[model samples]
Target: MTFLEKLKPHLISDDILIQEVVLHALHDYPNVPEEWTNELLKEAFRNKDKQSSIFIYVENQTFNEESVKILSENIPLMDPSERHLAVNLVQRIEPELALKYKNQLQAYIPKSTWALYELLLHGTEEEVYSEYGQILNDLERAGSDQHHLYITAKKLAACLVKKGWVTETEIDLILEEEIKGRWFSFNGILNIYMIGLLKLEKYIPLLVRLLERDEDSLLEELSATLISFQSDQVIKEVAPYLRKENSIIYAASIVENMKTDFAVQVLREAYTSARELDQQDILFEALCHQFSEKALPEINKHMELDYSSGLVDIEQTAYSYFSILGIKHRELALWRQVALERELDFRQKGNDLPSAPVRNEIRVGRNDPCPCGSGKKYKKCCGK
Candidate 1:
């Protein structure tokens, strides 16, 4: 029997046990027919005792607008866990619809702060800033439970940062308030503050402190903030970590953006220091493109080395370097000579090399040394 047929009986039933079974079935059979799917969904929603149906639909990729609207309307009736699931569903399928239900959603704010935070995160910056401002205003006007208000206030602070609305002075004020030692998660508050106040270079010291603390998921943000500076000082500070595998890409990216002669030199040195098996050719290409005139002699020297057996990779690498430097088109004659000589060497070694029309002026005589530096007669190496 098909999977849905097996799930059909439990799906139509009102038993709470059926909720788990339906959820499992949905998980196992994601492509099941909508007809059977809708029945199970309606059953889950109708059975107030079981909220697992909300989860089943949320997890299903096939769940669509009709299902979303039903869940969004019924969200007010759900308990905290179910409410969280409903909010997640709305955020996923219809964020604008979720925004429309914001007032009713606030009722669950004390218990579902993360849900509210996520909704605001996905909402437009204007909407989020406005909502956050209103929440702060409400906190100031009516004396509610300080704990809940503080949690919501912190969420607002984070939203403000992500939207780039918080000023440097505001960031300092928040930090001072956080230093007073409240029950809130200080790290989360500080992270948001850092992201908001990232425009000022003075905050680099604070970012360095956060990075040193090894706060979870903050390293990437710290790296991004550092990269934004795009100054020589920032590049020098981050240079030491380039040898580390995890830091290499970010370090290279920062160096690339710096666009200074020092950065190019560092990349060239790093390229030479890295093992041949390591993927340093891209870094070399980046350096070559950035410092074409300075790198020409080095490129020529490397191209003249013995690489008969590995000429294809070497040629492609050189081509990439030249291409990025915007010098390959001008150096076509030289590259054509090298390519012809390499092709001849491959043919002499019983390797199949495709024949193409010669388009360059550099003519390699039979007795001349191979351009590939294979250290053999041109006739034997590439002229065959």
Candidate 2:
């Protein structure tokens, strides 16, 4: 038995220190039996200690399947603070289980807004979405509190789009309500609007308005999303921004969205004009994604310059780019060659001598023990 198993009985009474220690130990060693974690949590709930409750909540946050079951069973009976923690834990660990207790959790929504937010954002299994729809309808009708309800609706809209239950039109209708009433931030509304446009690319005019109004960050995000639709109008809309000094980053991002040769040309020009490390890095990185046989010579030339100045770290970047493009190991032999050359040059220049050849030594003995670390002679073990 482990230390936590021995301390379980004492944790039942008032030995808070033992409980905390066992919890911390079990946290470090997650392989501990799920029953032990459940028992300690039950004891903490019986004692009504806030600190122990918090610890269990945190442990549940990091838990696997077995530990999550314990948390779900015990969460409803916990006090307000413990209940909130349990709700948050379930939302993260077992979202389906959390949805099972949605009605019971409704009372805590006002006090536990962040927990609700997490559930709406990431806890979006089918059951969780069903529960969210119920919650939204309930909040809308009852009018108990508007703050959490508005946030929940916005998140629900995003989740609906992701699930394909609601179309871009429905999302726009919701955003129209939100913007008119000043229910949420303009930026938040704009983000959801962009998501809508991403799904329904026909909304390019609206996106152009957002871009013209100086919403650069949102425009950049929208450009990336619009790439899936492969629309030239979107590229044209973002071209003027490409020339502006402040807008260069977003422009490069937009150019990456365009997969055509025209887009590659724009990226090459941007790479030439880009002076900052970050801008150059983004341009080169995007080019690597857009790489083709036709673009290889240009990439090779830029890589040579970057290597001489030590401005670009090529090996890691090349590996990442090739991995994304599904380029095989054999296809990237040129990159491996370049890396080997750089390593050799560094050794020769820095050490003032040619590197010695690496030697491999082989050993064998007929009557000796096997080199495989088995307690037997070579012939009887691996050699046999």
Candidate 3:
């Protein structure tokens, strides 16, 4: 078992030192199990030390009086970053409770944050829009960081557009700023997400032009935007990016989710023409994602060539990519999964190193709903 597995039982221990250590270790494990949710949240409030990762621990959880009490009582004990997160977390889950902390939290955060949260919770569209305007004035006066306003002011702006409150011209301007200001939110992914949400196909050229950008912060979002458009023009724009190290994963993902045989043909062609191992590794992975009779021979050929040449690092790279995919359980056929495992075994039996575990991590499983909000099974979309 890993250090986390060994220490996980102590996560809610009465002893603070052990719990804090375990809590810190929890950051390494992304999807904290549902059972640990309450205790971590309690510690998130109770711990005097920083627990900045409190957001991940309480991801799908909503607010309750119990959690609120714990958090409100420990607000003063939290570090600056922790306080920022606490305010955002509370505002998101239970904005009324966040408003209750406004007097206390204002000493630390961007101005008018709690007010915006309250408007979000209780105010009508008109009230929130009016408050949004007031926030712009406050931001200007303070010379506030756009990054600090994302969950508050930026969220309000997103809501305005989502509710059809913004004009198309206004949305175009917002899209430009959101995409350009990578640090303002979830990178260009969230920006492009607005476009996808609006089903704004005319802006594919805008996205295509921005491909010169290195906005790989969230491949799932970028991939979703491309999948939403699914144009030959998009596919054409993304094809060359398949060879680039930074962009290849989602470029390949875009091809995979397009779900056209032409997309498969593109991958096959990309693989055949590719020279570098890094380039081929990604192309080959996307081709394997297709999982056809054709892919099996190609997969085997790679195994035979690489393992026979004693390229264990190649296997290591593959394991790392699977981790990137965050694939809890691959949704392939029994034979297909075995084919993958057997290929790893092919490397292990010939080499001295133990086989890399085919990661059945506590991550998004292939059949799980896509986190990208695409409403398809992950395997059919981004995880494909």
Write down the lDDT of every candidate, Cα atoms only: 0.49, 0.48, 0.53
Candidate 1 lDDT, 94-168, residue by residue in tens: 234444555644443343654665666577777776766666566556542333454455556655666677677
Per-residue C-alpha lDDT of model 3 across residues 1-384, encoded as one tens digit per residue: 333354455666653323323343343233355456656776656543324434433543555555565656676676663355565455554456556656654554455665566566667789878876766565545532333443455566666656676666865676678666744333234556667667777877666555545533334455657677756777777888776666665577677555455777778777777787766766665654443334444545564553322212234323322332333324223333443564455445535423322121112334333434333445555666
Clashes of 1: 3
Separately for all candidates shown, the number of backbone clashes (residues 3 or more apart, or on different chains) is 3, 0, 0
Better of 2 and 3 by TM-score: 3
Best by TM-score: 3
Candidate of highest lDDT: 3
Candidate 1 stretches with Cα past 4 Å from truth are: 1-198, 205-220, 289-291, 297-320, 324-384
Rank candidates by TM-score, best first.
3, 2, 1
Compared with the true structure, the alpha-carbon lDDT of candidate 3 equals 0.53
TM-score, every prediction: 0.36, 0.39, 0.46
